[model samples]
Target chain A: DQQVKQNSPSLSVQEGRISILNCDYTNSMFDYFLWYKKYPAEGPTFLISISSIKDKNEDGRFTVFLNKSAKHLSLHIVPSQPGDSAVYFCAACLYNTDKLIFGTGTRLQVFP
Target chain B: GAGVSQSPSNKVTEKGKDVELRCDPISGHTALYWYRQRLGQGLEFLIYFQGNSAPDKSGLPSDRFSAERTGESVSTLTIQRTQQEDSAVYLCASSPPGIGNQPQHFGDGTRLSIL
Candidate 1:
């Protein structure tokens, strides 16, 4: 069973535009959500995260918005650059579980 | 301060062979994790280790898959008699103690291919 799901397999956007990636979760117990960006042959790098207590969190050009009632969250990258082209993975973790459940990931391509 | 490191970036072996993948976590990090990503799939949790405590191996696929950690620094994942289905990129991650809410730092991962 996929606890977390990223419906979009891929996305393309022009440079300097806003890029949005969405994710959904089946487990309401998850209290923390995170986004990671990965390049080819490289490990995923931490991007942004949001706690259940907060509905939104922003880090520089990256912003994460969470909707608890809908069991959904999204990552928005403003002024997307060519370097922003990578796979974005959404992950969730419950309070007690030390492991994080990851989604299938969305491949983002930014055209310069 | 270096990040997590994984060795043997790529390994190709015939079916029924055994392969060992290694990982070195960040300095002083007490938590380590292992995950597998099959092509065109999501990351699947395999195991977790926390400073001198028993590991959580609930996600291990089968008995043929096992792991070991030396202290809080290094870890090794061993796949015995590997099958074609075992081919995937094995990733390792680490975090500091009391930082479960924080994001994990990942290694480049070891890509294993069973031919």
Candidate 2:
């Protein structure tokens, strides 16, 4: 079973526009969530993360919102740039656990 | 290397042949993990090793799949009598020792193709 799900397979947005990606989880035990961005041949790199206790976390142009009640979280990239185009995977893990459950990933295309 | 290192970036072997993939995690990292990503699919957890603790092998899909890590260093994942379905990108990741929430640093991954 897929504990973490990213329903959107792909997304497209114009440069300098807002891009939002969504993810949902089935397990409430997951207390920490993270987002990773990946290019075609490289491994995924960490982007942003948020604890379940907080509703939002922001870093520069990227922001993550968490809603514990709905078991949902989202990553928002404001003023998206061409460099931001990549596959985004949402991951979640339980407190003290070493394994991270990952979503299928959503490919975001930011065009000029 | 500054990042996790995986050897033999691409492998193409005939079916039924055994293949071994290797990973070198970042120095000083104590947590290592293995994952597989098939075309059009997300990363699937395969195994994990933390310090001297027993490895978690629950995610291994079959008895033909096995992995070994020596003293928090290099790891090897071996697949015996590979099948076409086994073809995919196998990724290795390492994380600093922590209770949780540490983002894993991953290698580019070893792409295996069973023909």
Candidate 3:
């Protein structure tokens, strides 16, 4: 059973535009959500994260918005650049079980 | 390396063979984790180790899979009599000691292919 799901397999956007990636989860027990970016042959790197209590968390160009009632969350990268082209994975974790439950991931291509 | 490191970036072995994948986590990090991503799939958790405590092996798929950590440093994942379905990129990660809320730092991973 897939606890987390990223519906979009891929996305393309022009540079300097805003790129949005969405993720949904079935488990309501998850208290923390995180986004990771991955390049070819490299493991995922931590991007941004949001706690369940808050609706949104932002760090520089990346922002994560969570909707607890809907069991969904999204990552928005503003002013998207070519360097932002990579696979984005959404992961959820219960505080008690720190192990991450990751989604299938969305590959974003930022074109110049 | 300043970040988590994994060795043998790529491994190709015949079916029924045994393979060992190694991981060296960041300095002073007390938490280590192992995850694998199969073709076109999400990262799957395999195991977790924290300090001197017992490791969590709940995510391990079968008895053929096992992992060992020496002290709080290097860890090895051993797959016995590997099967074709075992081909994937095995990733290792580490985090500072404390609440599980902290994000983990990952290595480049070891890609294992069973021929």
Candidate 4:
């Protein structure tokens, strides 16, 4: 079963605009959520994360919002840059385990 | 700081041949995991190791897949008598111990192709 899903396969946005990526999960036991960015032939890099107790977390230009009641989360990147072009993956950690369930990933392209 | 490292960035082997993939997690990380992504598919968990506890093999697709971690360090995943269906990018990740909420650092995965 696909416990976590990123419905959009690709997203395009102009530089300096806001880029939003959405993720959904079917599991209620997942308490921690994270976002990762990946380039071609490289591993994913940790971006931002939020715990079930928190609704929002921000780091500089990136922000993550979690809606626990709906089991949905989103990553927002403001003033998107060409360097932000890459595959973005959303992952959820089981409530009490180190295992992570990852979404299929959304490819984001920021163009000048 | 250094990140997780994996070897044999690309491997092409004939069916029925055996292959082993290696992962060297960041120093001092206590949790390690193996995942595979086939073409057009999301990441699928294969196994996990935490501290000195017994490894979790629940995610192994079949008997041909097995993994071993020496303590909290390097890990090796062996596929015995590989088949064409086993082709995929095998990714390794590591996180800190006990705190399940930590983000996992992944390695540049090994791309395995079976012909």
Candidate 5:
């Protein structure tokens, strides 16, 4: 069973615009959520993360909002650049657990 | 030069053959993990190793699949008598020696294709 799901397979947005990618989870036990960006033939790089207790976390141009009651979270990239085009994966893990559950990933294309 | 490294970026082999994929994690990192992504699917956890402790083999799909790590360094994933369904990109990740909440660094991964 898929505990974490990113229903959107692809997204496109103009450069300098805000790009939003959404993710949903079925398990309520998940306490920590993270986002990773991956380029073609490259491994995923850590982006932003949020804890279950908080509703939002921001770092520079990337922000992650979490809604515990809804079992959902999203990543927003403001002023998106062409380099932001990549597959974004959302992952979750139970408190104190190292193994992460990942989503199917959303491919975002930022064009100028 | 300090990130996780995986060898043989791409490998193509016939069915019923055995293939070994290698991963060298970041230096001094005590935690290592293996995951795979099949076509149109999410990353699936395969195994985990931490320091000198016993590795977590819960995610291993079958007896034909096995992984080994020496000390806290290089890891090898061996698929015996590989099947067509075994084709996928196997990814390796590592983290520092601390709480599991830390983010993991990953390698480029080894893409294995069974012909």
Candidate 6:
């Protein structure tokens, strides 16, 4: 069973435009959510994360919003750049467990 | 300081053969993890090691799969009598002391192909 899901397989956007990626989770016990970006032949890199206590967190050009009632989270990038082209994965971790459940990932292509 | 490092970036072996994949976590990091990513699929947790504690092997698919870590520095995952279904990119990651809070630094991963 997929605990975390990213419905969109791919997303395309023009440079300097806002890019939004969405994710959903089935487990209510997950207290922490994270986003990772991956390039070809490289491991997933940490992007942004949100705790259950907070509804939103922002880091520079990236922001993550969490909705506990809907079991949803989103990552938004302002004025997305071509360097942002990569696969994005949403992951969740429970309070007691050390393992991370990852989504299928969404491939983002930022066209210059 | 360097991030995680994995060796033998790519390995191709025939069916029924055994293969060993290696990973070196960041210096002084106490937590290490292993994940597998099949083609067109999400990352699957395989195992986790923390300091001198017992490793978590619940995610391992079968008895043929096993892993070992030495001195909280390097880890080796061994797959015995590999099958085609076992082909995938095996990724390794390491984190600081906190669990479920700290971000994990990942290695480039070792791509194993069973022919």
Clash totals in order: 0, 0, 0, 0, 0, 0
Shift in Å, residue B71, candidate 1:
1.1
* Candidate 3 CAPRI level: high
Regions of model 6 farther than 4 Å from truth: none
Model 4, runs deviating above 4 Å: B98-100
Task: Please give, for residues B1-115, the per-residue lDDT of candidate 3 as tens digits.
Answer: 6999999999999999999999999999999999999999999999999899999999999999999999999999999999999999999999987754889999999999999
Each model's DockQ?
Answer: 0.92, 0.88, 0.92, 0.78, 0.89, 0.89
Model 2, chain B only, scores a TM-score of 0.98
Over A19-58, each residue of candidate 2 has an lDDT whose tens digit, in order, gives: 9999999999999999999999888999999998899999
Off by over 4 Å in 1: none
Docking quality tier of model 4: medium
TM-score of each: 0.98, 0.98, 0.98, 0.97, 0.98, 0.98
Tens digits of lDDT, candidate 5, B4-109: 9999999999999999999999999999999999988888999999889899999999999999999999999999999999999999999998754789999999
lDDT of 2 by residue, B45-77 (tens): 999999999999989999999999999899999
lDDT of 4 at A66: 96
Model 4, chain A: how large is the TM-score? 0.99
Report the Cα lDDT for residue B52, model 2. Answer: 98
The weakest ten consecutive residues by lDDT in model 6 chain A span A92-101
| DockQ value of candidate 3 | 0.92
lDDT at B98, model 2: 74
**How many angstroms is residue A95 displaced in model 1 relative to the true structure, after the best TM-score fit?**
1.7
RMSD of each: 0.9, 0.8, 0.8, 1.1, 0.9, 1.0
Clash pairs detected, candidate 1: none
- lDDT for B36 in candidate 6 is 97
Worst 10 contiguous positions by lDDT, candidate 3 chain B: B95-104
DockQ of candidate 4, scored on C-alphas against the true complex (2 decimals): 0.78
lDDT of every model, 2 decimals: 0.95, 0.96, 0.96, 0.93, 0.95, 0.95
